[model samples]
Target: NRAVMIGGTTGILGEWGPESEENRYEGAMTARQALAKSKNGATVRIGMTVGVDPVIQLCHAAGIRSPLRPFPATFLGSSEITLAELALAYTIFPNGGWRPNAPHILDRIEEKDGTVVWQSPEDRARQTVIKPETAYEVHSCLVDALESGTGRAARAKFGLKKFPAAGKTGTAYDFTDALFAGYDSSITCAVWAGFDKPQKIYSGAFGSEIALPIWVAVMNAANERYPAKEIAEPKGLQKVEICTRSGLLATDKCYDTVKSSSGESVHKRTTYVELATAAQMPTEPCNVHGEVRTRLVRDLPASGFPRASLAVDPKQVSPITAQGPVLLAENDPYNAVNSTLKPKPPPEKEKPETPSPKSSEETNLPDPTKPVLKAEAVEPDSTKPAPKAEAVETPATKPVLKAERVEPDSTKPVMRAEAVTPTPQKSPKQIRRAEPVHPSDQIPEEDILRPTPPPPSNPDD
Candidate 1:
């Protein structure tokens, strides 16, 4: 259950390529939990950890004859393979690490007279592809997937819970294809639904929606003939209580509690038991909780207060009573002695005393000590009448002068004024109009405009 970052782009080529189907950001979960949840980013991380070449080789050994590319994208089913091949590959899990032979149509052929004219070859011996412990672990995870994860509809919605079976649900990119491949001790089955030309079937068409039902129906029919049985736990495996948060041996502090929106406790429990091989069993107690507490203790004294001064009555601070349920973040304490103590609640505010309402007369009265001045009356002289205010006429009050309309003489030709286009001014300053020449000045226009020539030859004069 160690934290793994999920739903981010990862690949050698570009920023946009290879993203998880569901964009989860981060979570603390086991590989089995990751598998059950069908987390693409977690799966890609596993593939990178395991290396792409080994994964392809493992697939080949498990009966996937299809060619797989050596790339991280292949970890999320970028390579194409038939449903039959996939179902055959799943056989390795229930078969205790042994890869089964290719499925055949007939076990043997016989003549009509009951004398065998021809017969099928002897069954090929299964190949041991992986350790039994490894297979059982994967088988357990697949069972979890069927019971609670992507294939949960097979049990909850389709009523297949009674049967002991395990499977995975698959939905292709853009929901173009939906598939379900599963197996029991009795038989293996695979189902697929999609268009012949490879177009989207419909929006939100997941394998659990489209193909798991078919797989469930087929498995139910097969169960009648084969009588499905629980897959046996193989040897050399141990069960240990593991912290779901840290994936280490669980300690008392490794418990978790869930609360309702109203802050009521909903569920509370410590770690869950999980199967692990002798080599994989956790040796260390969960440090995540311990570290969190230690950090809180180390930082408390530095917060400008002595540890002794911060002590509180444990009876009043019981997490179960005061807080309902204690989450990891809420489990703040310096040591085991103080573990029951919770953070102090904010102080209650004191209510202000309401002022008495004042009477209207008292509120309206002026202060008696302050001087009150009154307006003085002035006597007017007998001979002088009060000066009258002059009437000031504004534009709106002023009378407008109207020009009289004169009738034009019809006998006289009326000259029409031609419309003139004004030339655009280059400069912003207004041009001054030339002054009209006086009629009394009879000088020639050229002589007036020309500069008077200096009297010819002052020397000759």
Candidate 2:
């Protein structure tokens, strides 16, 4: 269920992003399966693995004359080509890796007087582009495409299943163009549907819906004209059963089972045989089921004791018996506590004594240890008689002045201005807002002007 990367980049490539049409994750499909299903992500992965130059060279060898960019997207038909070039390219597969010369408009020209005026050149040598086995492998994949993949409509809907035909269906971006390229033993053909100026043809306009029907119609006539022959499997290619989940050699454990309502078990095989070149044969077995560890058993002489008697019956045992004293006699640290064979009884808790009732007079008496507070003196009656002022003699000696620390009154509010140190207020930090810059603006002038590296070339081509 992991997402596949396109062009080995982390970000999306917009509408050009390669993905499976079903929008579902299909784990570990073989190359043939990828080709048959037209898996864009898988195709790009294979192309990237093989490198851009080699892919371009292979296209050239297949007779594609159009200029192809050395970009990874080219694997998914990002580069455009003419129908003629595509048709010619498909010839190498059915022609056993031999690319035939360009077709002539006329075989020969004859005059009314029965004299041959001109004729097309003969004895043109066909180039060997790929090995026969490689071509056959690709042909088998194309055959799978017709039988079960994108081109299956040709067989299911168009009634083109009688002959052994191999083909592929291609739909351009946004359904701008649709094409079906295929071949049988005798003839190769390609059908394309699109306007000169590319534009959306219609909604859901796949090649199978638009172009395959026409190709099938043409092939129906060709099938009648030429006898159907089986595509021969070339030497050095063999069919090997491989695990669909791991793409490795199938093992006994590489299958699953399902149960039906009737209590019947159905074993679904996860392996299928597919054509692979000798060098491409699987070297390792399927690891998908390797982690299942089986329990091992061994036989030995029976014991003299009865097996039934060895079993412990928890139901018959009492809770006390099941959970006996935690500490044994020998392990007990307190001998006094374990004097009796039975568990010791818990000790009784002490009861608090109640105080005797006191007399009401004693209850009202103030505590002698506590300090007594004196009542304030009442002001003398203002209307009472005033006493004559008496002259008193001044004290013989001056009273010594004593400095005494006085406690602050509890009723009055105390000023703690010095106790509370002023808290320093922190200034808000300034965040410099940087203006958004375009990605192109960040690139250096030299880098922007630098020319793209030339695409690699094949010496053999």
The numbered model that scores best in lDDT is 2
Error of 2 at 9 (Å): 20
Alpha carbon RMSD to native, model 2: 27.2
Q: What is the lDDT of residue 346 in candidate 2?
A: 88
TM-score of each: 0.57, 0.58
Residue pairs in steric clash, candidate 2? none
In model 1, the runs with Cα more than 4 Å from the true position are 1-26, 109-118, 265-267, 291-461
In candidate 1, which residue pairs clash?
Answer: none
Tell me how far the alpha carbon of residue 298 in candidate 2 is from the true structure, in angstroms, after superposition.
Answer: 35
> What are the per-residue Cα lDDT tens digits for candidate 1 across 13-98?
12112122344334457788888887765787889999999999999988999999888878877688987888788889988999
What lDDT does the true structure give each of the candidates? 0.71, 0.73
